[model samples]
Target: MSRLITIDNGGTLTDVCVIDGQQVAYTKTLTTPHDLSRCLFDGLERVSHEVGDARSLPALLRTTDYIRYSTTQGTNALVQRVGPRLGLLVDDPRILEDLAREEETADLYAALVGSRSAVLDLGVDDETLEGELVTVCNRLAAEGASRFVISVGGPDGAVAERRIRDLLLAIFPRQLLGAVPLLFSNELIGGDDDVRRTWSSLLNAFLHPAMERFLFNAESRLREHRTRNPLLVFRNDGASSRVAKSAAIKTYSSGPRGGVEGTRALARHYGLDEVLMVDVGGTTTDLAMVRDGAVDIDWFGTVAGVTTSLPLARITSHGIGGSSVFHVTDGVLGVGPRSVGAAPGPACFGLGGTQATITDVLLLTGVLDSSTYLGGTFRLDVDRSAAAVRATIADPLGIDLPEALTRMQDTYAARMAEVLRTEAGPATTIAAFGGAGPMSICAAARRAGVPNVVIPRSAAVFSAFGIGFSDIGQTYRTAAGDRPDDAAVTAAIEELLAHAERDMFAENIAIADCELTWAVVDAAGATTPLGGRDDAARALKAGGRVQLQVVAVLPHPRLEDPVAISHTAFESSGTRAVADATGTRSEVPVVDLARQEHGAEGHGPLVVEGPFFTMFVPDGWTVAVSGSGDLLLTDIPGSSKEND
Candidate 1:
C-alpha cells in the first residue's frame, strides 16, 4: 500500500482519493459538519477496500505513506459562528482607534464584534507598545481570551509584527503564547487592507479551537490506522504543506483548491491549456478559469462579502448546491433556497424528511434513480417523495404532480446551465468535480452550448485528487502607501521582501528553493513589471496607490512539467432565497411568484415546493451529461432554430 490517501471536505460533500505513484482510487461521502474527519476517513476506508483486498484495512493504510486532508472546517466555523470569543491586540494607534470607534460590521465582521475583548490599544511609540503588551497580555489571559491577534499599522506589517511579537513573547513567556493562539495580521495578509487584515486574523482566531480539536482527532485516527507519517493539509494556494498546531487559516479554501488543481491535471492530460471548471455541490456552485493549466489569480475579489485582495486562484462561488428545495405558490411553481440537509436529506432518501425537495422531484421524474445514489446506502421512498411534492407544489400550482416534477428537474437544469454558460464564457472545455457536479454537468453544458466536457476519473472526490496534482506554492501582495521619495519606496520594498522571507521560513520553506515574481498595478489599474536589482522598484512606482503582487512556487520539485491550465473567462452569481428556506408553507406562494418572474428571463425558472426553491432555465438552453452523472446546461443562443 505504499500510497498516499487524501480527503477533501467541501461545504456539502467529502471527497476521498488514494494515490500510489500514478495509480489512484477515489470515493465521496456527504459532509458532516459536526465531525468532518469522521466522514472523510470513512470515505477513505471505503475507497481503500474497493481498491484492494477486503480484509486488510490496516494493511491498506500502512502501505500508504501519508494521509492528507483539506477541509472547509475553518470556513464553516466562521459562517456558523462556532468558535471561541477573541481579543484583538492592535499595536498601531490609528488602526485600533478606528476599529473601536467604528460600529460592528463597519468592516462587516458582525458576529465577533461584541465577542472581541475590547481592543488592547498600544500607541505608536516603541516604549509605549512594550508597556501595553505586558498589561494587555495579562488582562487578555485573565479574561479568557482563547486567541490573540496582534496587528500593527504599517506598510511592511509582517516585518513589524515579527519584531513586536518577540518582545511580547519575552514578556509573556512562550508557553502563554502557545496557550492562546496568536495570529499576526501582517503574516496572514502579506500586504495591507486594515479591514481585510483584521478580518483574516479574526477568522483565524475564531477557528483556532475547532481546528485544533478536528486536526488532533484526524491525527489520532491516522495513527490508529497504523500510519506513521505525519498528516499534512493542502493550502488554498495549491501546495502540500505541514500543519503545526497553529496554521488553520490555510485550510479555509482547501476544498476549492483541490478541485482547481485536479482540473489542471486533466487539462494537461488532454493537452489543453485553457478551460472552465464548474463544481456544483449541495450548498454552492463554484466556477473558475484555468489558463495555461493554472487558475488565474485575481487578487482583488470578495469572498463571503469580505475583500481579500491577494493573488490566489481566480474562482467564483454561488449558493447553488444539491439540497435546494422545491415549492409552489399563488398558482406558480419553484424549487430550492431551502434544503433537505444531511440528517433528513432528500424526502426520497427515506430518512424522515417530510418536505419536498429537488431530489424528490428528480426521483418522481425518473431523472435520478435513487437506487444508484451512494450505491443505495439508503432506500428511496418514491411514494413519500411523490406525496410530498404533490401536497406542496403540484396541488398549490393546480398542475399535475408529474408535470410539476418534470418542470422542477428541467428548470433546475436550466438555471445551472445559465450559470455555467455565463461564467464559463467562450472557453475551451468544461470540467466538473463534486458528487453532484458530474450528474449535473451535462444538463448545464447543453444549456451553455459548451461542446467539450471532462469528468475525470474520481470526479466525486476530484478536489482530493487535485491535492496530489498541484505544486507547492504561496501568494504575497502589498498595499500602496503615500509616496515620499524613491528611497522611501525602496525601504517599503525591502521591508515587504524581508517579511515574505520570514513568513515562508516559519512555514519551513527554504528561501533559495522558492521563485519570487513581482507585478505592479498603477493608480490607473495598468499592470507593469518592476524588474530591478532593488526590490523596491515596483512598490515605488505605485506609491500610495499601487497594488503589488507576488507568487512563489516550488518549481521542478517533483521534476515534472508544470500542469497547464487553459484560462477562460466566466461570469455567475450566488443568490439563494434564504427566507424561503426557513419560511413556513403559507409564505410559499408570494415567494414563488416573485422568484418565478425573476427566473423566466434568466438561465432557469424558479421552482417552489413548500419551503424549498430551486433554480430554473429558459427554453433555448441545452444541458450536457458528464461521466460522473452531473447535469449541466449551456446557453446556446439561436440553437432553437435548428431544433425547430
Candidate 2:
C-alpha cells in the first residue's frame, strides 16, 4: 500500500517514475555512464522535488514501498564488446564446429571466446584428465581468459560438465589471486541443447561482472540512506527479483523491454489487435510487437547473434535515436549504430559535441522550439545545432545548409519507415513513446503505410511508468521431457515451486500469499496454461513434449482505473514558423498541452509541445486527443506522407 518508484536506466538518460495513491510524477536525468549510480540518485532527487510532499531523497525513499529498476548496461556491453574474455572447454570439438558454421555465431565466437578454447579427451583416466585440464585451463588463463565455461555435448553432458568443473577448481583454487571463475552450462539453463546452453552460459558470464558491480553499488548507497525496500531489478522475462537472484544475461535490453510492457498494456486497453511499438530514446530505437494485446515471449531468444536458451521478449533494437551520429561518407547518408550517449549528447545541448544528430536537424527544420524544449529548464543552443549540422552534413556533402537539413530529414524518415515496414502487417497501429519517438513517428508511419499512431501523454517516461506496478516475482522452469509422466511432471513442479518458494522467501514474501501460475512450454515454443496440475499432466501425457514453467509473484501496488476518455477539444495557443523540404517557411499552430485541457484534436501543420518532447503533425495526418489525454494521429489516405 506504500508508494512505488520505477526507473528505466538508458544509455543517454535515466527516467524515474514515482506513483502515490492516485498521483504520478516522473523526471529524467542525463545518465552518468561512467558511474551509473550517479544518474540514478540524480533522477531520484529531481523526481522527489517534483513530488508535492516528498521534497527530498530521504523522505521519498522512506515512504517508498518498492523500487524497480531496468537497465541497458548488458545490451551496451555486448554492442560495445566490453566484457570479460571467456575460455571455453568442450568435450567434443563438433560443438564448436556446429556453432562456427553460422556467420553471426562465428563472429561472436571469435569476439568472446576466440582461440581460448580447448577440447579434452574424456576417455583418459582421472589423473591424465586432471593433468590435461589444469595445463589447458592455465594456458587459456595465460591467453587472457578472466572467466571459463565448461560444456559437454551429450544427453548426460551436464554431468560431464560438472565433473570437469570439479577437476578444474582443484587445479585452480578460487581463493588464489587471479584464479578465473568457472561456470558450467548446466547451471545457467535446463535445456538439453549443447550449443544454446553453452552460449547462454557464455553470455551470462560476460555480462555478470558489470551488472554486479553497478547494481550492488547502487543498492548499497540506497541502504545508506535507510531506505525501506531493497532495490528490485526488472528482468527481461516480464518479472522482477532482487539483484542477488537476478541473472546478468536476463538484464540485457531490459530498459527497452519496459517500454514494450507499457505498449502491451496500452494495446490491451485500446483493444488494438496488432500494434508496433517504436520506443525511440537518445541512444536506440527499440521495436516490438503487441499482438492480440500480448507480447510473445521468445523461448529460445537470440542475443546479439548468439542463440541462447533464455525466454526473452520478442523485441529488436536499432541504434538510431536523438543523439545518434550522422554519416555522409562517399555521398551516402546513414544514421547510427554508434551514439553520442549522455555525456556529450547532441551538439545542440552545448555539451561540446561535434556530431550532427536527428535532434539538431529537427530543431533546424523548425519542428522543435529551442527555448521551450525539455521543459525550458535548459534552453537549447540554436547556433550550435546549426553549426554542427553545416560542418558535419553540409560541408561533407558539398551542399547548402537548407538542402542538407532537408536531405537529413528525408533520409532519417525513410530509414525509420524501412525499419517499421520490416515488421509491417495489415491493421498494424503504431505506438510511439520515449523522448524522441514521437518526433518522426508520424512521418515514419505514413511512409511505412501504417494507418495510425498513438502517443501516450506520459510518452517521455512511459517505460518507467510501465514498470511502476510490477510485482516482485521470479520464474522457475525445468525440462519435463518428451513424454509427460504424471509422476515426473509432478516431481518437476514440486522441485521448481520449491526453488521459487526459497527465492521468494528472501524477498519477505510467503509462498502461501504469493500467486502461482503454471504453464507448459514445448521445445518448439508452444505454451499451454495448466488448469489443474494433475489433470493437465494427464491430458498432456500423450502429447508429451513440454517443460514446466511456474511463476511466483507477490503482488504490489497498482494504479486504479485511470481517467476516462474525454471528447473535449481545444484551439492552438499560437503559431510558429516551420520549414518545408524546399526551404520555404510557413506559420504552424502550437498547442501547449500543459496550459490546455486534454482531448484536444486538430489537423496537420501543428506542433504539440509537452514538457519533455515536441511532436509535429504534418499535412495528411489528423491529430486527436483521447479521453486519457493521449495523442491519436490517423493518417488520411492519399495525403502527403513524404513531406511530414
Candidate 3:
C-alpha cells in the first residue's frame, strides 16, 4: 500500500500512471477492445517495470494504496450507437413524445428503441392487461429486443409501473438463463420531470451491461493478482467510488472529467483566469473550459446530446480525433463523427485498416515518426499509411498525394482550430494533452488566436495522473415530495446519512474519516444551505418540491506544489527539415526530454520528445519550464506570423 495507480482507458490507448509520493512512473498500451482487462494489465505490467524499485506485478499490487480508473469506452459506444437492443414499454404516449421531441432525441430513440415499442392501457382488468403484456413481450422479443425500459407517466404512474413490474416478473423470472433485463425509470430517479428520468434510465441500462462486465472482470483479475485495495472508478462528479457503488450513467465522459481536473490544477498553478483544454484522444477530441479558475459543470448532464438527470462536468466531446475517419463528401474533405477505434486503429498501425485517418496524415507528413511512436514500442509503416491515404483520400479527391496530404492535415487542424476559436478568448491559455494532442496544437493554437500554450510534462498520461487528486466519495439524494415540515426534511437527511454510512463502511472507511455535507435542493435546482431544521422548513414552507442531497468524502493525498528549478540542459538529438500544420518548413532539432534535467528550458526551431508524446515548437515560440516541470510555450513578441 505504498503507490497510487490511476489508469485512463481510452478508445485507442490505455495510459497507466503510478504515483509513489512525488515520484511518478507512467506508460501506455493500445486498448484491446475485445478484452479490456488484457490492456488493463498490459499497462500495469509496463508501469510496474518503470517504477523506481522495479516491483513485479504482485509486489506492486500488494504495495499499491489505491487504484483508480476512468474510461471512454461507454462514450465511444454511445457515439457509435452500439449496445443491447432496447424495447421501451410505456403506459402513456406522452413519455415517448417528450423523449423524442428534439431531432437529436428522435435519432437516439430510433436507434435504441426503433419500432420495437409497446404502450399498455392500465385502465383494463389485471387478467386482460396480463394477456396484453404477454402479447407485447412476445412481439418485442420477436422484433429482436434484448433489453427493455418500462416507463409510465401522470400522477398514478408509479402505481402503474409497479403493477407492470409484478406482471413482468410473473411472466419472466430471473432464475431463467439469459433473462432480459428490465429497467424502470421510477427506480432510477424520483425527479418530477418525466423526460429527464426516462432518459437517465435508458442511458444507464444501455451502458450497464458492458460497464459491469468489463469493470468487474478487471477487478476480479486484480484480486487474482492479490491486490489489497479495490479498484475505484473515477466519476464525472470529480471523485472516485468503488465499482459496485458506481452507476453506468455517471461514467459517461468520465475520462474527460479527469482532464477538466487537470486543467483546473494547471490554471490554479499559474494563477490564470481562463483556460481551454483540448484532450485529443483516439475517437474524440474533448473540449473543456476553465473560466475564472473553475471547471464548468452541467447540473443536468447531457450524454451524446441527450440530457440526463445526473450532474456532470461540462466537457464538449466532438467526434473528431487522431483516429476519426476522413472522407470526401461532395468533393470536400470532412472529418468524423465516426472512428476506427483500437481494433483496426489507424492505417499506419498496419493492422488491416484501409480507411484514412488523421494518424495516417500525421505519419505521412512526418509529424509522427515510424521508429519513435508509442515510446518506440511499436513501429508505424509509412508505406501502409501512404497506400491508405492514396486509396481512401487522394484518388477519390483527384489530387496528387502531396497535395492530398497537405489538404488532409489542413482540414484536420482547421476543424480543431474552429473548435478552439469558439472556446478560447484573450485570457485563455491552451492546455494540450493526450497522445495526439500536441501533434498539431501549435498550428491550431496559432489559427485560434491563442499565444500561450501549456504541455504538461505528463501530458500523454495527464488524465490518469489527474485522477490522483480525487478523494473516495459519493453523493446521495432523495426527493422529499412537493412540500414538507421539519420532520419530513429531518427524516430524509437521516435516511441519506444512514445510506452513506453503509456505502463507506463497505470500503472499510470509518464514519469519522468521511466528512458529510448536506443541503436542500428545490425542484428548480436551487439549493438552500443545510444549517438546522428551521432552515429546511423555511426554505420549503414557500410550497415547492425539494430534495435532500448529501455528499460524503474521504480525503486522499493531494499533489505537492510545484518547486523552483533552474535550467539543466540545452541539447539536440538530431535535425530534420519538417513541414508543420501551418505549412511552414524549417530545420527543427529533436531533443529527448528524458535525457535532459528535470526542468529543462529551450527555444524552438525544435521538437521536444518524451517517451509517450512529442511536441513540435515552431521558430517563433520559446519553450520554457514551469516550476512544476511542465513545458510552457509562449510566442516571441515580434516573430508571430499571420496565417497565409
Candidate 4:
C-alpha cells in the first residue's frame, strides 16, 4: 500500500495523519517546543503503530511515498516578537523623516528598522556612499544585528536596492567568516509599494533562520532514511513548495490554509457554494469565509496589525481555544489572549497545571468524556478541573461550580459568535473542526445565528488532513503597464511562467507533469482568466494597467480515493451518561464511529466518538454518517437548505 504522511506542528500539540491507500490513521502528542522533531517522530511512531506497521522510524520513512509538513512556529514567533535581531538599510533619508512624523507609522518604522539600523543617503557621491555603507554595516553588526534588510525608496528604488545588495555581497561574501545575511526588498516583492514591500521583506528575513533550521533538520532526517521524494512544506498561498523554494513568511497560518482547502473539497462534495470554516486549535480560533465556491485570498495580508503584500488566505485568528487561559478580573470573567500551552497544559491534564482553561471547563460541563479523551490513552483529572474552575472563576464571583463553568462557556461562545457574525453572512454554512471545535461549535453556531453545522470524522487532525490534500504548486505575478498591447501582456505572462518552470525544475517536477493557468487583474481590481495568449493580449490592449498572475500546478502523490467507514459496530462498548448545553444530565448512546458502518444514522443527545475527537450531538439535531466517515449534522426543526 502506498502511504502519504502529513504532520501539523501546532502550538500546543503536534498532529500526525497518515493515509495508506484507503486506510487512514492519526495520532496527537504534546509539542516539544525545545525540539519539534521529537514530537514529530513520537507522533509518527504512534501513527505507525495504529496502522499495525510496528516498523522503526527510518524504516517507515523509507516506505512513505510523500510527506507534507505545516507548522505554526512562524506565527508564534511573530506574535511573540521573537526572532533574529534585524537591521534596516534605507536608501532615502526622507522616508525615515516621514515615518517619524506620525505616531502609528513611527511605531511601525521602529519595528521595521529595529534598535540597530542605519540610513544611507545613497544619492550622494559613490565614494561617500561606499564609505557610509561599510560603516553602517560594521556598526549594526557590532550592535548585534545578525540579519539585514535593504529597502530603497523613490522611483529608482529597484536600481538602488540592487546596487546596495551588490555592495553588501562584496563586503560579506558567502564564504566569508561571520558574514551576516541581507535581504533585498525588490527581490521578494515586485510591487511599487515601498513600505509594504519593506515590511514583507523584513518579515521574511526575521522568520527565515528559525524556519530554515527546523525544516532542514527534519529534511535531513528524512534523507537519512533514503526517501526519494523531497519534503514539501505547505504555504499560506494555498500551495506546497519544497523547503528550498518556500519563503518562511509564506508558511504563516499555513496549517489553516489546509483547512480552507478541505473546506473547498467538502463544499464541492456537498454541492454547497458558501461555507464558514471555524478551526479551533489549542492556542487560537481561526475563521475564514468561502463564497461562491471560492476561498477568499488577501493579496495584501495583515500580519501583527501591519499590512504586508504577501499572497495569503484571508484568515482571522482570535486568541481563544481549548488551552486559552481563563481568569476573573474585577469580578468579571474573561477568556484569553494568553495560553497555558502544552507544557503544563490545562488543569485537567494532571500535568502540574493550576490555571483554569477552556479545556478544563469542557470537562466540567460534561462535553468531554474523561475516560475516553485521546482514545482513552491519557486520563483527565476531574478533581483538578473542578478545583481550577472553583478557584479561578467561582470563588472570585461568589458563584457555584456549575455556574462558573456555564459563565465561562457562555462568554467564550458569545465572543466566537460575535466574530462569526461580523465576518460571515447569514446564508453561509458553518464547518467546525479541531480537537475542541465540536464541544463549542453547537453553542457558538446557535449564538451566531447559523443553522447548519458539519463536523468531519477527522476533525481533530483536520488541518493535517488538509495538508494531505494539497497540490504542489507556485504562483508568480508581474506588473503589466496600462493599455498594453496583446504582445506585452503575453510576454509578461510568459516571463512569470518561465520563473515558475525554473522553480519547479529545481524541485524535480518535470514540465510534462505541470499545468499552467493565468489570470489578469485590471486597474480597478477586477480579475479575468486568460483563455489564451491572444485573449490576454487583446484585453490588455483594450484596458488599463494590469497585473498578470500565473499559477503552475505540479504533480504529487495525493489521496484520491474516497475514505471508507469501518464496518465495526459499537454495541459492545455500551452507552454513557453525558450532559447537554442546558445542564440537563441524560444517558446518551456512546457510538464508536470507527465501528459504525456506512450510511448509519443517529439522533441528538448521543456521543459520537472518533479516533481523536468527541462530538456531543445535542437534541433537535439529526446526525448522518456518510460513506466517507464524515459526520453530517443538520438541524431538524429550524433548518433551511439554501441553493448556491
Instruction: State each candidate's clash count.
Output: 87, 2, 2, 3
In model 3, the Cα lDDT at residue 553 comes to: 48
| TM-score of model 1 vs. true structure | 0.75
Candidate 4 Cα errors over 4 Å, as ranges? 97-112, 115-136, 153-156, 163-174, 325-334, 337-339, 395-412, 480-495, 522-527, 532-572, 580-584, 638-644
The lDDT of model 4 is 0.75
Candidate 4 local lDDT, 516-607, one digit each (tens): 56556643234567775566556556653234433344333232334333433334246776655455566778878888766667776677
Q: On residues 453-566, what C-alpha lDDT tens digit does candidate 2 reach at each position?
A: 999878899888888645676765455545656776676556666877788888877777777666666666556777655644554455443344434543333433434435
Please list the residue runs of candidate 1 whose C-alpha ends up more than 4 Å from where it truly belongs after superposition.
11-13, 29-37, 91-110, 113-129, 139-144, 156-163, 173-178, 220-229, 301-303, 426-428, 476-644
Per-model TM against the reference? 0.75, 0.87, 0.84, 0.87
User: lDDT by residue for model 1 over 1-644, one digit each (tens)?
Assistant: 24677778776667777776655666767677777776866787678676766736677777776666787878777777777867777655566555446464454444554434445444357677778777777777776677778776666555577877877777766775787767888767655567567766776667667677777777777788777565766777676655652356667777887888877766765567777877767656788878886677765444445555344577777756676777666665655566666657777777877778656765555434445455445567889998888887778777876566666766676767767866665566888766566554555666566655665545556677777764444545455455556666666667666765765576566666666656565433334555643543655555633333333342210112323222211113322221111121211111122122211222332221111112233335433222222223455655442110
Best by lDDT: 2
- Model 1 sits at a Cα RMSD from the real structure of 10.1
TM-score of 3: 0.84
Candidate 2: regions farther than 4 A off = 101-104, 114-146, 158-180, 324-345, 353-356, 388-407, 480-491, 535-545, 552-567, 637-644
- How far does residue 101 in candidate 1 sit from its true spot (Å)? 9.0
Q: Is candidate 2 or candidate 3 better by lDDT?
A: 2
